[model samples]
Target: MSAASPLRVVCLVPSWTETLIEAGVNVVGRTRYCVHPADRVSTIPVVGGTKDVNWEKVAAQTPDMVVFDQEENTQAMADSCPYPWVATNVTSVQAMPAALEQLAKALNCDALLHMAERYRAALAAPVSRSGRQLPLLSDKHNSSLSVLNDDRPLLYLIWRKPYMTVGTDTFIHSLFTHLGLPLITPGERYPEVDENWLVQHKPVLLCASEPYPFAGKLNAVKDELQLDALLIDGEPLCWYGIRSLRFLESLQSS
Candidate 1:
């Protein structure tokens, strides 16, 4: 539907929720985790979360269409949706612009179409490294660890307590690949690792700041693992859609 005839949508993907709202789509419902554009999304009704959607609450919204992501919402949720639904599967940096274009076509939002074009242009621009290095340790830690410069293999951590990391197939891994960082993990989707695994692999560690609040426990994690670990922003690394465009732009300047 065009902006003149906007479709009432229930968006479950957090990143897409932000994109659709910014694109001026009529978002009637959203999951609890869709917390972007805080001023705008606060007014929308909640339909549970990415995995545990409240179908009844979603039905209450009486939305014209429901949005899902292949990596965020479950297949059963989409299959069980009583109303019309659409799902976007974006698994890499190269796939994001096309996904935005497809969504723009589906929603008939010119803003989204423009955003897709911007993403395309940003992706086409050459990335400038400028020799910027990410700090690997906090000031409190007395370690010889410094910022990363070389092409050493890195293992990015998303969760702890039986730590979890993304595989080569995930969107996060694709972003890492875009940054020219070599990943040491296997090809499987989110793989769980233990202290033993970390010791055996001995890859540089990067703890993401979301899905587990890794930033708060960075020191503890470093102490426990006895490995050089850095806290990273999870949003730019993992969140796709419009955020991906901004991320690409940032890389172009870097």
Candidate 2:
């Protein structure tokens, strides 16, 4: 639908929900996790979480279209969708611009198209003098900072207990790759690990603030693993679309 004839859309992806809302789309329904632009999304009806969608509630809204993410929402959900649905897949930072463009075309939102071009230009811009990189591992007790080497492996932890980490094919990995960090984790997706595995691999540890609140237990993790770990914000690394574009812009300005 064109901007003049706005379609009633339901967005399941958190980042996409924010993007659509910012683009002035008539977002009729959103997943519970779509919390950005807090003032606006708070009024939108919550269908459910990303993985568990209430199709009944979704249908109640009579949305003309529903937006789904290839990774966040299950294939079954897409198959079950009664209304016309659009699926967005952003597995790498390099693919974000095209993904935004595709979504813009599907919704006929010129704002998203402009965002896509801006995002593309931001990606092409040179890294600032401060260095366009995520926070490095620093020890609180010691003044020495661990240097990141291209040859060495960096492991970014997302979950706890089993200590789940990301694989090379994930969006998180792509973010790190863009930051010039080498990830050594193996497997296709989130992989569970134990203390033994961490000891064996001896990778530089980075704990993320989301998917799990790694920041709260940062010291405990360092003490348990006997390794220097840094807490990193998960938004810029995982959240794509508008959030990612803003992050790239911030980096350029910095």
What is the TM-score of each predicted model, taking all chains together? Answer: 0.90, 0.89
Q: List the residue pairs that clash in candidate 2.
A: none
Candidate 1 per-residue lDDT over residues 1-254, each given as its tens digit: 46522888999999999989888899999999999989999999999999979889998998988989998989999999998888999888889888888888777788888888898888778764422433233445433444455455588888888789998888888766666664778557899977777788777778877888876687898888888777767787777877767877876655
Model 1 lDDT on a 0 to 1 scale: 0.79
* Poorest lDDT segment (10 consecutive residues) of candidate 2: 141-150
Model 2, which residues run further than 4 Å from truth?
1-5, 128-132, 135-152
Candidate 1: residue 33 lDDT (0-100): 96
Off by over 4 Å in 1: 1-5, 129-145
Please give, for residues 1-254, the per-residue lDDT of candidate 2 as tens digits: 55521889999999999888888889999998999989999899999989989989998899988999999999999998988889998888889889988888888888888888998888788764221267433345321234343233678889988788998788878866775565778576899877777788777677887889775588888777887667778887788988888887877766
